[model samples]
Target: MAVGRPRTFDCDVALDHAMEVFWRHGYEGATIAQLTEAMGINPPSLYAAFGSKEGLLKAALDRYTERRAAWMEEVLSAPTAREVAERMLMGVAEKQTNPANPPGCLLVQGGIACGTGSASVPFELAARRAQTEEQLRDRFARAKEEGDLKPSADPAALARYVSAVSVGMGVMASSGADREALAQVAAVAIKAIEEQSAR
Candidate 1:
């Protein structure tokens, strides 16, 4: 029996590069050739390490989510529900426009335009997004219990509203909207949250 050679490339670094390629070109748009070139790994290495292109994408999504865990925690830990909305929307504004990263979000851009062959990709991304909305709903429910939001406020609705705005901001960013535009969008979202909480 013969042993295969050890991988020379760093998996994390390669995944990060693959993530950027997916983020920039989307799932259907990104080719294996592009991913391999960006990741600095050959096709055989990618297949051996990730099993398949979808596998690599799943791994990249996991890495992207893990990188944002801290920020998500901070947003959820805000002192008030309004502040939570403020932090979330404004944070997205900053993140989506950051010069260092590709515009928009991986979860949003990665599967937005998937065709029939890649249909499952959109659902996978949607499930991740729904998880975010669920988290927001739970947080807002807690805020209502704490009197941070009015008793009449619907936590689920507020969560959906915020989630929708956040997703729309990502689309806007992908469409070349600047930070200032997103900031204005966030401001309006926060105001809506405030009003909704009051009512």
Candidate 2:
């Protein structure tokens, strides 16, 4: 059998566009027309490629998590676990409040206002959010074993604290909080980590 030709539309490019739509408008609020228009594909083509609006959103979410989450890896690469968290908080503050992109996080904005039919959307987002915190926890746990973190520190609790601050910053950014305000929020969260620092 002969190999078929590749898709004319670039799935990654289209998905990036779709992500912006859902990022700006919550899953419940983003209309199919808006999505199709933003993706530069007709309704039939959109359905054929993505199955449905939910499917398209799923693909978009996957792209967002995979690509955007790369930043976390960099933040996690700091010399110490405390630096990892501080970098994560400050980076989030910077990115969330960036004027070039939509304010707030795609992981957060996509899940808010999700109807009962869209319940899985929020759960999916929650899982992704939890996954990042889990990563942080593992890093902190290693730090404790390596003597970078105080033995008395609770890795899980610290992870939860950072996750909470990150989520709060997203919500505040969505509500029009300025970069300086978010920076202050990040600073407050980092202070707790600083107090826990071995140095």
Candidate 3:
């Protein structure tokens, strides 16, 4: 129950535009007309290609996580839990301030100004964030099993702490915090992990 595909527009290119639009405006604020306008596609074409506004948002969010959060996956490869934490913290400090990309993070920004109309939007955004935090928790749990972290260390708490700091960093970045400030914040976060992991 949709329309024909356009010969002139590329899905990937339009998705990139939609990602920026969604990044600038939170999930609830992004309108279908705005999305189609940014994608240079009509309503039926958009529906045919993406199913609905929410579907298009899901696509844009996937693209954003793949492209922007690649560093998170990379950090998970570090040899130690401390290394993983530090690398992830530092990476956020660097990327959140990149002039080339939109400030803050798509994962965190999506729910910042979330409203009641599209209840699923906040749930989707929160789920993505929770998924990342769960990764951190798993990483820390493994570290504990491997004796890198203390046997008594609560992986969930450590993961939540790091996640909270990361979210704060995103908020600060969106509020115009510079790279140096974010770096200082990252240092503080990494230092806390270092102090605890040393135990």
TM-scores for all predictions: 0.96, 0.95, 0.90
lDDT of 2 by residue, 1-199 (tens): 9997666688999999999999999899999999988988888888989898889988998898888677988987788977888899899899998888789998899899988888899988899899999999998898888888887999999999999999999999999999899999889888888788776
Which numbered prediction scores highest in lDDT against the true structure? 1
Give the per-residue lDDT of model 3 (tens digit) for 112-196. Answer: 6766667788788778888889989999888888888877689899889988999899999988999899989888888877766
Query: Whose lDDT is higher: candidate 1's or candidate 3's?
Result: 1
TM match of model 2 to true structure: 0.95
What lDDT score goes with residue 32 in model 1? 98
Ranking by TM-score: 1, 2, 3
Q: What is the lDDT of residue 39 in candidate 3?
A: 92
Q: Model 2 scores what on Cα lDDT?
A: 0.89
Preferred candidate (TM-score higher): 1 or 2: 1
Query: Candidate 1, residues 57-115: lDDT per residue as tens digits?
Result: 99999999899888999999998899999999999999999999999999999997788
lDDT of 1 at 52: 91
| Model 3 worst lDDT window (10 residues) | 110-119
